[model samples]
Target: MITFYDFICPPPQATKSGNTWKTRLSLNYKGLPYKTEIIEYAEIAQLYKKNGIPPAIVFPNGYAHHTLPVIKDDITGHDVFVVDSLEIAKYLDKTYPDSPRLIPDVEDVDAQIQEFQNQLNGAVIAALPVMFKASVPHISENSQAFYKAARVRDLNFIFPDKPISSLDDLQFTPEEIHATWASLEQGFDGLSERFGGKNTFRWALGDHITYADLILAGLLLCVKAVHGEDSPQWQGFMTWSDGKWKTFLDNLGPYLSEDN
Candidate 1:
């Protein structure tokens, strides 16, 4: 059995973190049996420390940043905790060689996929303001306070043109929001073109699914989960780039289950 740690959000928007979703998708893709352990935003570090799981990253200031998408694997006959989605996927693949590989075994394939993910994530930045705004109401007050403080301390540069002392300050004008969405759509279009045009390929690397596909799907699922399938944000996204994203996500439907 595997204990997958994910962050918690209020009803109507449960499981909104894209980083965690990446691991969930990977686990499901490999047919791994796991249960979710939902942690609040402020409790991540404490829980990790208690379980002897190390932080995902550490800053120069010595602050250890513990994050979700961590998995405690019991199938290996011992408690092996893997932090970070990418690391968890790699761990799963290494431990369960019989399962389909998420990170391809080909030489340089993993590096290529990582580069693709990096570029793809750059495109997602434009949409962050809107996505963050939509997520505010669904977060608990305590978590909200925690995130607001963390943003001010570590992510004040997100809005360099203006000061962001509070989460509300992250908001953008209606025009800016529209432009951001348009920019994201263009990014998706460019990604599709790189892989042989829109709707031409079912997965990131031709027919077989890989970590690259999960990376993209994780972001899309986060949007869908946070904004709701009926919201204009999701509706517009589904139709973007001649419905390429919609088709791509649909192809991943079998692995989209939330087996909590």
Candidate 2:
């Protein structure tokens, strides 16, 4: 049996992280059976050493590593570690070829498909500073360093600045909140133009649902959660243009809904 180490913040129930969401999607798609070990960020040190993080697979040997879509083959006693969401999707396709394929094999079809996946993953992660900084008071230094290094665009980019820290304090006045909201709005707008417009795309690249759809659907919930339902920040960008995700989820729905 595979043991998955899971984090409980950002309210996992409310909005599962890209890593967790990707794992669940793949597991569900593959009919994999696994167990979960849930822990708060502050307790990660005590839970499974300081390096523990959800999406990580704990082997029978008790070793834990940062991996997403991790799989432990109890039958063979083999522990597989997969990091990136796209990589996980591809791994699933190769490992379980009979499962529903997320990305088609044709090179021409795939090139376009990958573009949208990049936009969804890259654009949403462009604001990693905001999320990581907010998690500072709760997580360990190793986790902070991991996120800072992972998110650095260039050598000089120092994240967790005083201004960014201020937002975490949650003491902002209306003006400050508006300013912060404006910046987030602009950021999402840039992402929308690059990934969500009519010509921007349905799946990040073409019309079919691929890794991009899973990424977009997950990130959309995060964005919607941040910008209140009443806020005009992403009013127009809230819904997928063609209702693809809605149709896919149908009764279940991809988003967390405005009421959440």
Candidate 3:
């Protein structure tokens, strides 16, 4: 069985990291027999150090800190260490050819999935504050301090000065929140067109659970982690966009794998 090293929050109910979820999605999608090892915030560097995941001069690169999802596959005799969610997915699909594929074979379809992954990442960054605020409390106190500082840096990029020292101190008007979500909407460019006209996509690729679907679902799951299943954030987003976002989330009901 593959040993999937993933992140954990305070009660450890769900794997909060979107990247971790992506790896988990591929693992489950392939029906791989993998067990999880929960790694805390401070332990990320330790994981790399112990596993000897040395920095590489390779194209995809390696160990750029904050590396949370690392997998160890011992089934192939010697241990094989893999990091980064996308690479992990590609590796799993390539190694286990008999299983369902996360990445499709067609070049154009694969390109579309890659495009959606980029968009989902952009959306997550634009809506970072909301995700961090909801997630901060569940982290270790030590990690909470670091997470807040890091989020403040990220928030400053857009918010400018007036650093947010705490989640409680973070303030955004309803209009401001709407604007952030508006930015996130841009990340979904061609997605909504599939359902009807505006803000409607039944799936990342109509009816198929591709890597794009996993990535998109992972982005929303980050938000869901902050506020639970029926979060007000989801409701507010739906209200702002004529229930488009809510419908998208609802459509992804089946692919909700919680743990790492």
The model with the greatest lDDT is: 1
User: What TM-score does each of the candidates earn?
Assistant: 0.92, 0.57, 0.77
Candidate 2 residue lDDT tens string, 176-217? 645654554455555555444544343444455456566656
Ranking by lDDT: 1, 3, 2
Order the candidate numbers by TM-score, best to worst. Answer: 1, 3, 2
The whole-model C-alpha lDDT of candidate 2 against the native structure comes to 0.49
lDDT of 3 at 140: 72
lDDT for each residue of candidate 3 in 1-260, tens digit (9 for 90 to 100): 79998766766477677778878777877877888888677777777777789532232333144565778998789899888777788889888999988877875876786676665565556677766676787677767776676566557655675566556787778898778767765655434554444644466666667777777667667666766757666555455445666676576555565543
* lDDT, residue 184, model 1: 87
Poorest 10 consecutive residues of model 3 by lDDT? 55-64
TM-score of predicted structure 1: 0.92
Score candidate 3 by lDDT: 0.69
Clashes of each: 0, 2, 1
**What are the candidates' C-alpha RMSDs?**
1.9, 7.5, 4.3
**What Cα-based lDDT does every candidate model obtain?**
0.81, 0.49, 0.69
